[model samples]
Target: MSLIRHAETSAPNIFHGAESDVGLSEWGHKQAGLLADHLASRGAEAVYCSALRRAVASATPIAHALGQSPVVIPELHERKIGPLSGRTRDEGWGVYEESKRRWIAGEVEFSHPGGESFADIDRRVRPILDDLSKRHKGGRFLVVVHGIVIRVALTSLLADRTPADFDAIAIDFASINDLVHDGSRWRAEALNLVVAPSPARPVA
Candidate 1:
């Protein structure tokens, strides 16, 4: 299965958490189109996305390219940022970073004020991914989600890896990461694969 991060938003630097419903920016739409073109021939049998607008929009083009409708799963939404929802990095990053630090240091119970903890994300996300993997056991599918969701899910899916191990791995917008299920386990195939579009062409 291919796990994809949603394309950029209008305010790319802002913390648009699970409660925020922002859609794609102009460049984000172009990126989404490019992603669609890149995956059109990959023979994906289904497409899934978080219930958030950005994720839904990102999945639309790919789903169209594959001739399948996207299935929106609310449980796949990004970690709830709570009070940090619309704050820019400069305004609220400290609290967010500290929470992540605590999570990586084995403090899974720590959360930003009103936000979800690492354990909260793991509890809700893993079962859904497991079920989806089972449903598409012998086939490929697409799942459009957020960067943090991808990171948290990876930590849980891979036994050897931990949240700290993936701290340096950047999950860019519209990037594709592949996961393979071998009947009993899931493993990462490729990660952070990006498809850049031509600079001269304008997206209409």
Candidate 2:
């Protein structure tokens, strides 16, 4: 299985939540094509994506390239930012950082207002993985989703048994992380395949 983070979003740095309608940026468009070509070479059996627009846009071209329709799974969405939906970067990151701190300290129920707790993520995501495992069963497939979703899924596979790990690891845009599921167990192969690198963030 292959997990690909959706290409650079129109709202690239904000705490884009479930309700965020941000699509791809101009550079993200080109990144999508890069991802498409890479997946085309790999010959994926099917292409799946989060319901988010950016994720869909990211997957559509790749699906077209592979002659398959992109499947949108609502469960594959990123962690919901709730009240922090459209905050400035610093403000949102401030809330996000503190939330992560409390969450890592074992406060499983801690969440931004109207947002998902870490447990909520697992509860929603497990079914998706279970459904996919049965449907795909050893088949190589593509899932285009968000950075945080991939981290939580990978952490779950590693038996971390936690609801959150906001700082899990940095997964760049348009990157592919390879994994394999043999009916019961799951394991990752490669990670952070930067197909089209974005411009470096300016120094703060």
Highest TM-score model number: 1
Point out the worst 10-residue segment of candidate 1 by lDDT. Answer: 195-204
> What RMSD value applies to candidate 1?
2.2
In model 1, what is the error at residue 153, expressed in angstroms? 0.4
State the lDDT of candidate 2 residue by residue for 74-127, as single tens digits: 878888888888777887787887767877787767787888876678678868
Which residue pairs does candidate 1 place in steric collision?
Answer: none
Which whole-number lDDT from 0 to 100 does residue 38 have in model 2? Answer: 76
Candidate 1 lDDT over 38-61, as tens digits, reads 999887989999999999999999
lDDT of 2 at 93: 83
